[model samples]
Target: MTASKISFACAPVIALLGMAWGIAMAISTDHSTAPVHAHLNLLGWVSLFLMGIYYKLHEEIDGLFLARIQAIIWAAASLLIALGIALIHMNNPVGDPIAAVMSIVLFLDMILFVVLVAKSRQ
Candidate 1:
């Protein structure tokens, strides 16, 4: 499947998982990891869905290795950042470094996304 299809397909799955997590959190009465849940929904679900839509709309953006690389980096970084935030909330010192590095990856992914979209328009 194409990168856009991969992105679009994963979004709802991630969103459903996020919702289940939220419900579990509510039931357990432990909102300590709300940041993780929030990030999972926002970064994993919403942002990914939007990026997929962008790719779908811009046909000219297809077949670019950077687009696929961005998607891969984004998916990995999102999971890392969310997990890191959760771990950090639980007082794990290692979480900070994990999130910090992944944050940079996510930033670079965004920059690449913008550049790809811009180039597609040219």
Candidate 2:
């Protein structure tokens, strides 16, 4: 499947998950994991969906290897960071390291995305 296709498919699923998580938090009256929910929605849903739209509009870069790599990395890092943050909020010290590493990975992935967008023909 094309990178755009993957993005389109994954974005909504992650959004649904984020929405469900938010509802659960609200019902429980515990917003400690709000950061995780926000990250999941922003990075997993919003960012991926936007990138998918960009790829759809720019056919030239839709199937580029770097674009595909960026999409995959974005999804993975987003999930990992959310997981790490969730764990940290639950009092797991290990999540600190996990989140720290994923944060750097996510930042580097965004840099790659910026380069891809800058170099796109359309």
Candidate 3:
């Protein structure tokens, strides 16, 4: 399958994991990781799935190398955000910086995605 398809396929899996994590947090009465869980579901699952749909609907987007780059950045940033939040929830000193960096990366990734889409339509 194409990278776009792969990215889309990952959404539900991430969502399920996020749901499980939320349930675990609820059971444990710990909402400390709620930010990470929300990000996983929104950015990791929803955004990626939307990107995939865009690529699927517009074949021209699939031809752009930026599509692959966007997928890579999205996946990597999602992991970093999740990991960073988990670390912060556990009171790790390095977590804040990592999450901050990943937040910037996520913004840039979205910018790149927008550029790719705009270019594809031209």
Candidate 4:
């Protein structure tokens, strides 16, 4: 599927998962994983959905290989960061390294997005 389609398809699923997670936390009265939930919503739902809309509006760049790469990387990194944060909250030492690396990956994905947007006609 196209990058835009992939984004559109994945965003809602991620959002639903995030919402469920939030509700679960609320029920359990444990907010320690709040950061992970926030990251899932922001990166998975907000950022992905916004990028999908942008791709939809700007057809010129929608089909570019780099756009697809950016979308995939963003999605993967989002999940990775959330997992890392969750693990850290669980007191796992490896979580720190995972979170650190994924954070950089997410940042680089955003940079790739910036380049794609800058190069696009619209």
Candidate 5:
């Protein structure tokens, strides 16, 4: 595998980190860690690697607007996820706005994923 693939593999590391952090939070009674850990796992790890794979194999996507839509959704999802994770970690109430944006980004990403899968099957 190339270095990019290796880097992609590290995405799961973030999920493991989230799990570890969650365990720590569970024992410590810290209110901040649960959401932060969840975001780290779901966004930092899973979504990031998924986006990279999406872009890398985009030819398989097979739609006129899919590329642009994927780009926008991926970028937005990454940015909002990072921002939301940070806000959550720092105990900032700004998470509401960040989460809202991330939610929309995730929705778009899911739609694109389904469309790409359907197209690839044809």
Candidate 6:
């Protein structure tokens, strides 16, 4: 399938994963768990697959640029999740700071992606 189509496919998967995460979080009543669970859906299953489609559809974007941005997403997401989890599990690790940085990076990446896609349509 084309990359853009992959994005559509991934969106729901990510959403569903999000739901699962919510369910797990709700059922367990345990406040101390690794935040990796959130990232698993947000980055791994959701972002990876969604971005696959975004890149596929927004064919105008530089493949290399998108790939690089995606790599950054994965790195940041994973890092943030790891740190967040640590923080959640009773550690004051650099969780919030790291997650915040990654969130900003993700925003930048999305903006860049949108720009490239728009330019490509021209």
RMSD of 6: 4.9
Candidate 1 per-residue lDDT, tens place, 4-121, comes to 8778878888888789889999999999889889988999999998998888888677556778778767877888898889889989999999999989989989999989888876
For each candidate, how many residue pairs have backbone atoms clashing (under 3 Å)? 0, 0, 0, 0, 0, 7
Output the TM-score of candidate 5.
Answer: 0.55
Candidate 5 C-alpha lDDT tens digits along 1-122:
33234326556666676677778888998856566677767776776577557545645542346644554555456546656766866778897688777878777777876776676634
lDDT of candidates 1 onward, in order: 0.85, 0.92, 0.83, 0.92, 0.63, 0.59
How does each model score on TM-score? Answer: 0.92, 0.96, 0.90, 0.97, 0.55, 0.55
Question: Top model by lDDT, which number?
Answer: 4
| Model 3 residue 9 CA deviation in Å | 2.8
lDDT, candidate 3, 11-105, per-residue tens: 77888877888999899998978998898888888888888888887787775677877887797788789889989999998999999999999
Better of 2 and 5 by lDDT: 2
* Model 2 whole-model lDDT (C-alpha atoms): 0.92
On a 0 to 100 scale, what is the lDDT of residue 117 in model 2? Answer: 83
Residue 118 of candidate 2: its Cα lDDT? 88
Where is the poorest 10-residue window by lDDT in model 5? 1-10
Q: List the residue pairs that clash in candidate 3.
A: none
lDDT of 4 by residue, 1-122 (tens): 67899899888988998899899999999998999899999999999999999999998989999999899888888888999999999999999999999999999999999999999986
Window of ten residues with lowest summed lDDT in model 6: 1-10
lDDT (0-100) at residue 23 of candidate 3? 95
lDDT of 3 at 65: 74
Looking at candidate 1, the ten consecutive residues that score lowest on lDDT are: 59-68
Top-down lDDT ranking: 4, 2, 1, 3, 5, 6
